[model samples]
Target chain A: MKAATPTGANIALFLAGLLFGLGLAVSGMINPAKVIGFLDLAGAWDPTLILVMGGGLALTLPAFHFILKRPAPLYGQKFHLPTLTQIDGKLIAGASLFGVGWGIAGFCPGPALAALVTLNSSVLLFVAAMLAGMALHRLLLE
Target chain B: MENFTPITGLIGGLLIGCAAVLTLWASGRIAGISGILSGLLFPHKTDTGWRALFIGGILIGAACFAWFNGGVTIEIQTSPGLTVIAGLLVGFGTRLGSGCTSGHGICGIGRLSRRSFTATATFMFVAIVTVYLTRHVLGGNL
Candidate 1:
């Protein structure tokens, strides 16, 4: 399969990022309080997050099924899908840790990055620490 | 719940799904925020350029939405210390886990991958429990 030109691929990547950030902002995911409200199942229990996930899955589920059937993507030479299939301790442990952090702060990586546009001090701090954490993981694990 | 916002959430989620589809089709990449950000931090020769452009697009996209929509609402309830701690956990955990919500939750589940299913279940369960502990048991406003 012939890959698309670099310029075409770069433009698509840029547009994808744009759409992702815009979507996060519009969905109110950028608001930590909204995320906390959804996570607070026993409390007020706002269900907006559920709809968000549902909506995302609605499109992605069918789209992925159809797209992967192709030998290659429209532009890319090959799909870079993950190869691992096992369920192991590392996955569970890491997910658990991430869950704790997400519940505590109501900030995941995507919304956290999108929220940076607001230039909020806490957002800045979290992103910095997040980068440091990534670095630490590489140093300690990889 | 009074805080429920179905329309915006669905629309936003669809946008996110579109972004994921576009990225995969054009560049054969998963639109996983953690992976993208980490790749930028630890740059590779051919990969760095696209990652940078994508992230820059995210920032600009958010800014554009804020500018056009009279500003998006954002509420960060976590204290600075807690935010930092949470950020660290998320960064480290996502890296160790090999994916986050976008990667595993949306894309992985869309592909019907067993590992993604397990990861999503684990994180969702743990996050629910965390909210219970922080909100009910500890009775903290975090």
Candidate 2:
């Protein structure tokens, strides 16, 4: 099979992103209040997020197994999978911090971006701060 | 359970899985929103167009959803101050840990990566505890 051209690859990526965002919107993950409700296990817990995750995992597990069997992607030269295997202080600390933030605002990266169409002031603020935080990490750590 | 939405949640998750699969098939890239967003922020030469288009697609997808559905409901429960702080933590932490819900929680675990499992468990546990502390202990909605 001929390798896909750059344009074709970019088109596929765009479509992928579109579908991902649509999923978030449809699943109500774009709503911070719903996300917090899921997190609040002690409160009137909402298990919708669990089912969402379960559904995602159910499909991806088998799909990834089959896809990785191929030597290369249909469009790209190779799969750019993560190679890190260590469980260290940085990973734990970073995840812990992220969890705190998520619990506080109920806005993870994907949902926040998808929700940007809302043009809500809070969403805008959160996203701007998030970008600043990423820049800060690059400056301080990397 | 008042806010539970099992059907939409499952359907939306399957769509997200399909998005990840498409990205892997076409670009050999993880559909990690944080990583994708960061790449746009600190762009590398010869690797910027697709990222931009992908993000654009997310916004467009969301807009399309609202247009079709008459408007998606998004509630931001956190105040502006807390939203900014949470955004900072999420941005920094996802970068430090190297993935968010879509990346680490879904794709990474689906690939059976041990590191992803550890990160997911750590973040999930911490997020739960944080919610418990904030909602139950603090006795006020954050």
Name the top lDDT candidate.
2
Error of 1 at A102 (Å): 0.3
Worst 10 residues of 1 chain A by lDDT: A1-10
lDDT of 2 by residue, B50-111 (tens): 88888888888888888899998998777888889999999999999998999998899989
TM-scores for every candidate against the unseen true structure: 0.96, 0.96
DockQ of 1: 0.72
Q: Model 2 chain B — which ten-residue stretch has the worst lDDT?
A: B133-142
CAPRI tier of model 1: medium
Task: Place model 2 in a CAPRI quality band.
Answer: medium
Instruction: Give per-residue CA lDDT, model 1, range B20-61, as digits (tens).
Output: 888888877788888899988887677788888888888887
lDDT of 2 by residue, A4-34 (tens): 3388789999999899888898899999889
The 10-residue segment of model 2 chain A with minimum total lDDT is: A1-10
lDDT of 1 by residue, A1-142 (tens): 3333478789999999999899989999989889989999999988998888888889889988888888987775788888888999999998898899899989889999999999999999999988888899998999
